[model samples]
Target: METFLGVDYATLWFLVIGGLFTGYAILDGFDLGAGAWHLFLNTEKDRRIALNAIGPVWDGNEVWLVIAGGALFAGFPVVYATVFSAMYVPFMLFLTSLIFRAISIEFRSKEPMRWWRQSWDVAYSLSSVLLALLLGIVLGNVLQGMPIGENFEYVGNWLEFLNPYAFMVGVCTLGLFMMHGAIYLIMKTEGRLFLHLSALVQKAIIFFIVSFVITSVYTLIYFPHLSDRFKESPALFAVPLAAFLSIANIPRLITKKKYGLSFVFSSITVSMLLIMVAIELYPAIIMSTFDAAYTITVHNGSASEKTLGIMLLMAAIGAPLVAFYTGFVYKTFRGKVQMDENSY
Candidate 1:
């Protein structure tokens, strides 16, 4: 018999994972979109507007990532340890890039020299690209399964990590985020910059559409086990179909010049894709290539019932507060970014 505590634990895990990704899409989406359009911003004023568009909210956006990580650590320590231990190098690189990007955003303004500012801007853009790619690769690796021994430890060498399927997944992830970022910038900025950013988004959307199609086909053909899962779980197909439909809606949204709608559609595309991936990997938190029995699932990988219960209680109180604070921040700062000498 299931207790209320067990149900609560399950519900809280779903909420935290879903909420973090949603928050990430809504918050980091604009920043990434702004960075994607950075090269097109020819004037300092344009660049500053791009920068300020994300200024007040970027710090807050990072909180979701922290929460996600903390939830993973506390609720699923085994998965956390295995993932981090296996992918230590990539994780370090990801963290380093994020740190530099965050610091550079603040420090760039303080530098009076053109070269210094330009250097930081480049760092910001590159870091964003790397971070997105790393996330993609990580997702790809999870989906494709890793070499896990009987002891539930990773057995594959670092070099063998970049398989063809994983690479394709990485490409898909990178392209999707780039497109997601572009849509975000189109919604947030105005004037010639907005027009230019819109064009960039259109191009990116096309690229991602092609990549998505190719990746979908590849996954179907090469990953027969996953394809079998899709066949077995007919209901799960809705997620990817929704993602595809969202992709299709982008052109119409763009044609109408409905930037906000375009952004929404782009976000839907991402959210649906994530949902599809999660569905595909259901019950298996971490799949094992070396040993089938070694696969980690929510039942086996999750924390103790008592700990999960307490975490659920804390999340119940905290999640609403997070939502309210995020909404307030966005509402308070709602407007086109204006460039000023003091802008940072």
Candidate 2:
């Protein structure tokens, strides 16, 4: 195994993959959250503004997912193959929702008829919510542990993926996204829409808090192992503490009409929570419910040292370019969305 800065190449790639997915969650999460709020807006104009708020950057945000997938394939092909094969149904549904989401955005504006627009609006919102839930559900199953038999093959029934813990996690994820999206919408609108979102953000904050509390309690009671790392290493507690503070601060910022900061904290909340998950499953990417031996860790699942090293070099060169491009796009489209001819 190649060593870089006291960490092995596989560990480095694990961090890289985690960072990529975290970026995706922070970037794409807001838009999906925004879309989840679609049907809640009263009028067509409000819906249009909501849609256009994410118009410029939604597709670009998805690029992180594509990159994350590629990185998974490159860095840990075994884990990728095993998990994807195991969760094929969920992933397929996720991909289908992504397609419908894109199509809804593009097709919604093509026809001026009310029925056409409404149909796409429903599709857009439903797809957005479904996507967020599915992501959480998948993560939940990963954390709760999958039933992998010999050769890393899934041994459980397909429907087993929808167990209580996974469903709860999915709900929590939806709540978080909704809160995050409301804050983004608040930052990007003015007048009536802003006021509406302002009121709605309060509800979103409560939704997230309730869901978060329930999920945390459930995890501690049912899955004590997830917290063993933090208990063993007191310093790692900082991540969860930071996550809590970040979440706690959201309501305060929202009350002060400091939406920009609220959005920042929302992003922080997402990052901190994911970081906590990474901390919980440091070496293990996926746990095996059936047997400990089948659990996939960075060491057992990574690519060759040379392959990882070369890929790390390429990632070093490419990641910055993608970050820069993402930043440029956001900077270019900053501020309140204006309904022009090109707007979604």
Candidate with the greatest lDDT versus the true structure = 2
What candidate 2 gets wrong by more than 4 Å, as runs, is none
Model 1 C-alpha lDDT versus the unseen true structure: 0.78
lDDT of 2 by residue, 1-344 (tens): 56999999999999999999999999999999999999999899899999888988999999999999999999999899988988889999999999999999999999999999999999999999999999999999999999988888889987888899999999999999999999999989999999999999999999999999999999999999999999999999999999999999999998888999999999999999999999999799999999999998888888999999999999999999999999999999999988888876
| Model 2 TM-score, all chains together | 0.99
**How many steric overlaps does candidate 2 have?**
0
Cα lDDT over the full model 2: 0.94
> TM-score of each candidate?
0.94, 0.99
Stretch of 10 with least lDDT, candidate 1: 1-10
Clashes of 1: 1
Q: 321, model 2: CA deviation in Å?
A: 0.3
Off by over 4 Å in 1: 1-15
Local error of candidate 2 at 56, Å?
0.6
